[model samples]
Target: MHEWADFSVEEAGGRTTVVVTGPLLVSTIAYLDDDLRDLEGPVQFVDISAASPIDTVGAWVIYRFAAEHNAEVLGASEQAEVLLEAVEESASTADVAPRRGWFWQRVPAEVGAMVFELGRSMRRNLGFMGAIIAALLMLFRHPGRFRVRALVRQMELVGVTSLPIIGLMSFLVGIVIAQQGAIQLREFGAEIYTINLTGRISLRELGILMTAIMVAGRSGSAFAAQIGTMQLTEEIDAMRTIGVAPVEALVIPRVLAAMLMMPLLGFYAAVTAIIGGAVISQVQLGIPFLTFLSRIQEVVPVTDLWVGLVKAPVFGLIIALSGCYQGMQVRGNAEEVGLRTTRAVVQAIFMVIVLDAFFAVFFTEIGWG
Candidate 1:
């Protein structure tokens, strides 16, 4: 069924009339545009009356032809006339959308957008920190408003439930460090220094760092998911309506729990790691386990233990704040809950690592290395 469009030029009284024939819809007139554009028609009028059931595409082609030849469109029915007029009006000189630029041009624009987003994120985080501080002040003024039960529950979740996994990770990491250190130091006939490497690294850095990473992955993600779900269900909105501050009811307890438990957890991880190091030293280096433990006391300073404890609470604060802030930012749909939860975990871990680096530099300068 070929109902393709066709046009015939007829000359009458020194005038050219293009008699358009066949169905004038898009599918029929597909090749008509090139034919119309290439046509040189100083001779005349476009007569579309002979055309059957003309659509916008046909109208546009005919209108373009008539305009190029300075001829009037004639013999058009009401429908064809309406379409011609509409097409004529829509061929605007103004740009509807900006055209894409070259790759070099796009790169700078993309970089600027990313920098702007980073700045906006920092400002929002700072504002959220202020809100948390203000909520703390409110709770301080009215001590009875504190939710002790929620705080206890969060403590158990973030600390007690997390213990076994944190212990296991630290243990494995200690074994690796001890075994690796012994192998390396054995070349120099200094294999006994494996105890020093294990004890000092675990106490000063690895224990707290690994614990923070785990907590960020676990508790931080949980905070974002829980709060984001609450936001989706309008539970947060309901609390606000009932004159309850979300920060006080939900955030404070989690923040407090993390802050209180992190130091204890970090110390526990360090001790567990030390035990692991002892196990490795006894097996590989032929040192007695009790002797390895006793050596750790002499080689590792009390200052290393203080360093881990000092950093724990600060890391906890950052992780909790990042999670709660991202959770509070969630909006629109159920998919937003997952997105925000992921962002919370990523942001917490990134900030934790960055701050850890800064602390390392600062503490080393202050002779706490």
Candidate 2:
């Protein structure tokens, strides 16, 4: 009968009745909540027979007052009764802070959890690799299914466009290596050997290793973010619904691009780095740049170049796989995309470094050291 709720208490024949009236809604509850709380009495019953269109907030207010006064509710309509009961049922205790244990116990638990998750992650990554391999095989069998345009686009993104930055980085790194090596070797009157150090290190390790890291940070993160956005937008699902395989369309091209482009990029990086070292050689070491460049062939063996070339494609494969795998793992929300993108870059770099170490050991054992 009224837009706002109001209550009045009546006493008759040793019984108290708190009569509630009007539309008890969220927008109107505030008008009478303070007044209701101020009343102190042995309230026996809360009569809402005149209350029209009660909302959850109104039901909650009435329920709390009745409970506090040890009074019973009366004349609540079916919907209002259901709302009151639902609010009552929803109440519960929850921890205000995270649970904790003693330091020693907590450390072990955390370590165990980390190890378990790492193992689980490795298994999942292996499964994803297997799936990619199967998809590649299927594409090979049905050559018509392979996406050439996508592959070319990824190659441009992963390799061609990256040349300027990678070249600059390699150039600076080479300069640093030559400059630092000259500083240290000057002590033994072996300054000329800076060429050997610069050539060998750039070709055998830093060139490809740093390139892989760059690709992981750049292309890998981009892959995760792009694919993750597609996933969130349900474009991946749409692809599946329309009989287009996501892996063949999205992942394969990227993988192939990285695999094909890394070798070229690695070689390019090494060449640029040597030019950088040669500049330092001419400027600081008083050796002619062209002479220093020519000396690299004689001082740095063919095996060093082979080492970089061999490792390049494998590193690229790991980086691409990490990116695509983490991207595909995205679900639920936008936050997941960010988390997966970071994971992709971190996972790619970590795997690349680990693989580089393994390759080092393997090559040394095989007489390529």
Best-fitting candidate, scored by lDDT: 2
Q: For residues 238-330, could you state the per-residue lDDT of candidate 1 as single tens digits? A: 999999999999999999999999999999999899999899889999999999999999999999999999999999998888788889999
Candidate 2 regions exceeding 4 Å error are: 1-83, 96-98, 101-119
RMSD of every candidate to native, in Å, equals: 6.0, 4.2
| Per-prediction TM-score | 0.74, 0.81
C-alpha lDDT of candidate 2 relative to the true structure:
0.94
Error of 1 at 294 (Å): 1.2
Q: What is the lDDT of residue 128 in candidate 2?
A: 84
